[model samples]
Target: MVPNVVQKGEVIAIDGEWWNSDPIKVEAEAKLSGGAPNVSDAFTINGQPGGSYNCSKSGTTNFSVEQGKNYLLRIVNAAVNNHLFFKVASHNLTVVAVDASYTKPYTTDILVLSSGQTADVLLTANQAEAKYYMTASVYTTQGFYDKTNTTAILNYVGSNSSATPIGLNIPEFNDTATLVKPCEAWLRRSIQWTYGHSSSLLLQHIRCLYHRLSFTSPVEFNYTGDVPNTLWAPICGTKVKVIEYNATVQVVFQGTNIFQSDNHPMHIHGYDFYIVGEGFGNYNESDHNPFNLVYPPLRNTVGVPVNGWVAIRFKADSPEFSCSIQKFYKFVKFDDVATTLDVSKGVLAERVPVGRDIGG
Candidate 1:
């Protein structure tokens, strides 16, 4: 843990959302819409749909806070298929960690969490003695989506019980500018990885895996721009790139317009990597020159920006686990196998051992 970097957690709160939907119906809808699942019937907090949702006011998730104390909220984006913008009315959040990895404290008015990502933020109870709304609203960059915002209650001790809670103003559903703040500011340390951009059918990918074959089709045009119908098809296959143990590697995840340009929450299963650099448009090799190697945000999952790219790096040292990277984007049915690190290998006579993992 970073010494003295984390704030005091006088109170702890678990923030997450639950979806009210039928599993069988949701699956059928995805198949019918080419993997697009039906919008969540309700966005809930701690299983309560909050005051704004139907007659759930009495059941809204509430946390009592004392004046001058701090509450550490462990926020998780448990939504099935949406990136969410989280914030509290009249409160600034100091982000201390993400995905269980400590990061330099960065304060902001709002936080954008892609599905499957987690954040630890400290919220100080310094506002007037009243109730306020803690909210999560959908954040996207392309196509139609559910624009609903869910809320919970942040009640100050001794506040009027019947007083109306101040509401929060979330960014617009397609607010890409607001989403860039956290992605650019998250910091820690490490080297890099670039993930290829494409979508493919799970059946075709599995077929490649079964035959021990690799298929990686690259889009040479403007990835973030208007993509033709010819480039919209899935690049089906299991593409693997092996990395040696203890090697500093860079993997860049490039966002494409094949189907739509949207934020993808890319996650590495067995490693915490440093997000050294990220930007919009196609990635240039020169982008590596400005990487924040000294204080890059170390995380297990990072949101590859809409129509942009993100570079992550880690040393292949985990000698027992084969890491796999998965993109937590809505409607994606298969994990892209872009980079596989071979770390299970033991040290040879003169060569050091290597780690194994895949990035897509």
Candidate 2:
């Protein structure tokens, strides 16, 4: 979590549905074991609801910047259960960092950020002296209770204008293909984990001994929390995923489940993972060949493509006992984890079984 001590712009973070969508509620036994997606609902920005009957744009603010100056715009996805699409009017963002790690200065008009992820971009106020709408909306896979466009305006200094800021074009709602097929090749990793001259041995060790884990959602929609024995409950737990220190780890988040297919922005706590590959349907060894060891995007939080899977690799360099507790369940497990983890660890049960059944 980035500290508030740093300078940050005024932008509303839409976490989850406001009414009853809490982190604890999403991991409830009913949702985990019973296959209920009782995540968050409509939320208010800075305590202000949306416009046009709580579904349209709301809680708009203004950030005044001088003309002809470049500013570093740091965007964060604080949503607990959703990935957001962000854009500004007539501006091409030069992305430099993601999840606090640097990238290859990729430029784009719109960027997709999942929950808990951060993108640092350089925005140049080269446009005319006017206000432009900087909008944030849900980039969803499940066509559910999506929110209206959440916006803030980029106002120019020395301009005494109360006119409405011009809004830019956001991606079409429910456009997974557009979201998945990124226009630019951001999958290349700009950073490499080499320990000086021992890089070859380090890579060898990482390739030989590695831990593979899989995470998925429930299969059937029920409320009794009595899922069949074939599935794994999305409950919170500690002391889970204990591994030896310095072990190489490869994790695959499978999205093709029997219950429902959705996009999940998986976040890691200690280190960033090199996003090796992402594709549709189940993951097969022969099918997923020529892994992007050359250059892949490394991030602490990466997403599982809707109804698909994503593969990531990283060294377990940071070792510590981390805890994963259900936000509402009062149950705190003291896991002796070699690699401390975030929320996704709990939802991940053993490796994906044969045939890639999320539950069985």
Q: What is the alpha-carbon lDDT of model 1 when measured against the actual structure? A: 0.68
List TM-scores for all candidates, in order: 0.82, 0.66
Against the true structure, whose TM-score is highest? 1
Clashes of 1: 28
Put down candidate 2 lDDT per residue, 33-121, tens digits, no spaces: 65445544553343333443444444445668888777777777666556778788888887778888887667778878876678887
In order, what lDDT does every prediction score?
0.68, 0.54
Lowest summed lDDT across 10 adjacent residues in model 2 is found at 196-205
Model 1 C-alpha lDDT per residue in residues 182-203, reported as the tens digit of each score = 6655532221333444322111
Worst 10 residues of 1 by lDDT: 201-210
What is the TM-score of candidate 1?
A: 0.82
Model 2: residues with Cα > 4 Å off, grouped in runs: 1-59, 181-184, 188-243, 320-360
